[model samples]
Target: MTTVPPFQRALEAHGDAVWRYLRGMVGAGAADDCFQETFLAALRAYPRLHRESNLRAWLLTIAHRKAIDHLRRRRRDALEPLGEEIEAKPQGDGAIWSAVATLPPRQRAAVLLRYGGDLAHREIAAAIGCSEEAARRSLHEGLKRLRETL
Candidate 1:
């Protein structure tokens, strides 16, 4: 069997996760652009990737950074107010997704990474470019805020 390049293998493995992360970051509307940008950036940086043990985490880290960058740039340009509320049920109770969605970007990212993506604290920290402690704090604060809304 022909061997797949590391970069290609990484893309195949993590593409959906990265896209999901981007969707949570930028909403579904702009997710495609952010996804493209993320992989493009990854393709450029793939040669410098020295670790093969945790390619999923590495690719997620890049995607997270790209999503943040995209959000920053979008904020600078014409920005639209967040539209509509998303309703979610936690522990079988209905809650407004808008309430949780109101969290600051980093906290939202942390929460989404944890609950939505089923990632561990370390993985969330890697994706958000923060310390594991910071990621934990964000998740804690997000859950606290969400509870208040509930």
Candidate 2:
């Protein structure tokens, strides 16, 4: 069997999507911190990861945890997330993203995973620690809310 590279290689390969997912999760300002924590946590747990594990889903799962931690810390500070959200947009997608950013956290994560990270519902379910049906429902609700808002 061919051997795969380790966490460093995985980080280089999937960093952009993970960063974007974290940005969508907690906004740009906090994304870097969460991104770093995700890899750090992943580093600690890397040795235990199975060879067949989906690295993208695994990284996103770690990112999700880091995001939750960041949100909790932000809550302790009494700060709003989207209040200081992404200062940059992907050109012509600003309105759509604004609507997306207003979505409830679970819905937002669902949307981001489905579209931003290009993850299947099953992978998203794994990343978010939910049932596949729940991931689908969250995506549906998030899209409905986005349509309504936009």
Candidate 3:
């Protein structure tokens, strides 16, 4: 049977990638909270996992879900009548990432997983819960859109 590595090892190995992915998905404002939620949920589920295969992808899947949740909450919060909040725009690489944030959810995720997380198409398929072909298409469409946007 395949053995699972210690959770700490997985955290050490993948934390940055997951954080970057979250930042790409939800913006820096919400990325930290989403990152924490991802790892917290992963910590809860890690023991139930039977094998250690693709821990990075697994963590990314959790991160993706957390990002989605944060985005939804942000959308909901935006609809409420709260005082105007001015968030500082990110600079440098953030400019490209801001364009990335404009893509549809699946496409954004596909781009982030491929470029930011450095995950293979198959790993991205697993992370985003789609077929490999679908993942590839999403990545393609996202990149194509980005090319036009930039």
Q: What is the TM-score of each candidate against the true structure?
A: 0.76, 0.88, 0.87
Please tell me which model should have the higher lDDT, number 1 or number 2. 2
TM-score, candidate 3, is: 0.87
80-132 in candidate 2: lDDT tens per residue? 65734653545466677667778888998999888878899999998888999
Candidate 3 clash pair list? none
How accurate locally is residue 65 in candidate 1, as Cα lDDT from 0 to 100?
Answer: 79
Cα deviation in Å at residue 41, candidate 3?
0.6
Select the stronger candidate by TM-score from 1 and 2: 2
> What order do candidates take by TM-score, descending?
2, 3, 1
* Model 1 / residue 70 / CA error / Å: 1.6
What is the lDDT, from 0 to 100, of the residue 142 in candidate 2? 94
Total backbone collisions for each predicted model: 0, 0, 0
Query: What is the model-wide C-alpha lDDT for candidate 2?
Result: 0.83
Q: Model 2, which residues run further than 4 Å from truth?
A: 1-4, 87-92
User: lDDT (CA) for every model shown?
Assistant: 0.72, 0.83, 0.83
For model 3, the stretches where C-alpha displacement exceeds 4 angstroms are 1-3, 79-87
Top TM-score model: 2
